[model samples]
Target: MLESLKVLDELRLNFSQSGLFILNLTLAFIMFGVALEIKFEHFKKVILNPVSTLVGVFSQFFLLPLITFLIAILLRHYITPTIALGMILVASCPGGNISNFMSSLARGNVALSVSLTAIATLSAIFMTPLNFSLWGGLFTEIYSRTDASGLVRPLEIDVGQMFQTVFILLGIPLVLGMWFNHRFPDLTKKIVVPIKRLSIVFFMGMVVMAFMNNFDYFKAHIKYIFLLVFIHNAVALTTGYSIASLFRRNATDRKTISIETGIQNSGLGLVLLFNPKIFPPDLAIGGMAFITAWWGIWHILSGLGIAGLWGRKRKRVVTIQ
Candidate 1:
């Protein structure tokens, strides 16, 4: 079992230049669609109730990273170092693009969710690099003493390069989308939905295609990865919900915060892992690859399932009343 899992550490996926371009474009499109849903009024509203927004931010940025490191410490004996770092990377990332829709589905505060998304994403531009580097360095030190076969890469990040990528991919598209939406509200409403649907389909399809290409390898080794991601995601959701409850937030804010915390931008994680300049193909192969890729798909399923359950429970309570 150990050896089989180790094979993942050396197993490299084929990534073409055209594929990288497509992936970059797909992520930019997704970010743009997410931006289309944001409005200046949403920021104003978040500022109006700063407590909930602050709590959500704390849960996502600081609390999540702290807990993720704890989780890595606890699991260090059981899992490879690379796998634990993958969890850290995902935890450090911002909220997923669909968080607002999921929050609304769960009858949560949609505007608050959108506001958190905007803040988290912008913050992630800097925080992601910082958090990943710090936590990843710690993981490396601990693992170096524990295991001879290193499962992770050198913990160096080019801050300037990362900043440039985030600015182009996330910031530029966001600014453009916001401007377009503000300029043509009706057209924005009509096309935003289609853009979202198409981008999600394209993104997910490409991810699945790449993973499925090595079906046998991944199939043989997905059990442990799945279990790790499940636990990590649970921790993330609970952190948000617990933090919000401590602040005495309402039920809607609690749900929104929980969803925002749970659904990370694993897509961004994947892009970073795949970036030749960031994590080399060899260093990104096993635990990192599996964890982020599985996370990309699993979070959507888990988020929707949780939201559906919340929706159903709320409906039942209303009916009873």
Candidate 2:
């Protein structure tokens, strides 16, 4: 099994940058398809149910990062700063598309999940960099003690570049996807499913490329990477559920929040990492890539279990009542 995996990793390494770019383009196209499924009215409903949406946004954008920052501080005492920063970077990301899919499977408020994911993704154009800079700055205070070579990159946090990227990659593609669905419903349906499957394959290819290029770096940072990702994901799940409970949200809202907070836009993370001036740890790049990839898969499985239990418990309560 190990040998087979090694062979696969090497093959991925042999894959060129052109292949990686193709994978990214596939991801963009898949996201465009998802956008087609989104109804503008779905986002509008948030205005009606202000509490749930507000709570979700708060947990996603604010509370999760706050909790992550605290945890990162504690972890810094014992671990390298690269790993700590990596956790922060992942936590700061918005809810991913998978969160919407998982929320639907969990019998949660799928509309609410979609709304939060949309809002969070849009907000991340600014929030991601700001939160990263804030946490990165804080880490700088403690980073001196921890020996992480090339931890500080020239991260200017260009709002213009970020906005442009979001418009092209997310906003514009999403609108186009929705338009296509509206105009050619049958074609949209046909393409959506295939594009979704392709997106997964494309994502896996990117991960393989990362492993191939930086296998040694990942090997060295494997422990820190795993530990950081585990803790970061745990904090995200806790923040989502805890905040929902604090606000006395319903079962459905709680489930939505949990998935939203836990799943992150790792694609955005990779785009940010690629900027040499911005997070310059080549090893950290591999670490974030591997950890996020594995974490994305694990979180979905864990979410399924949690959502199942929540649904079952809710049903039982209603039965007893």
Write down the TM-score of every candidate.
Answer: 0.95, 0.81
Tens-digit lDDT track for model 2 on 1-321?
222222222222223457546545755775675676676777788788789988999998888877877886765556445445556677777776567777876778888998887678667767887787787667756665554443444234554555455455676677787688788888877877677666666666656655666666566555555565666777788889899999999988888998899877776665555444343333234334555555655565667677777778777888999
- Model 1 lDDT, residue 76, Cα: 77
Badly placed stretches (over 4 Å) of model 1 are 148-153
Model 1 residue pairs with clashes: 8-286
Model 2, C-alpha of 299: deviation from truth (Å): 2.5
Put down candidate 1 lDDT per residue, 99-172, tens digits, no spaces: 88899889999889999998887888888888888888888887787777654345666656766777777888
> Which candidate has the top score in TM-score?
1
Number of clashes recorded per candidate:
1, 0
- Residue pairs whose backbone atoms clash in candidate 2: none
Model 2 error, position 158 (Å): 5.2
lDDT of 1: 0.84
Q: Give the winner by lDDT.
A: 1
lDDT for model 2: 0.67
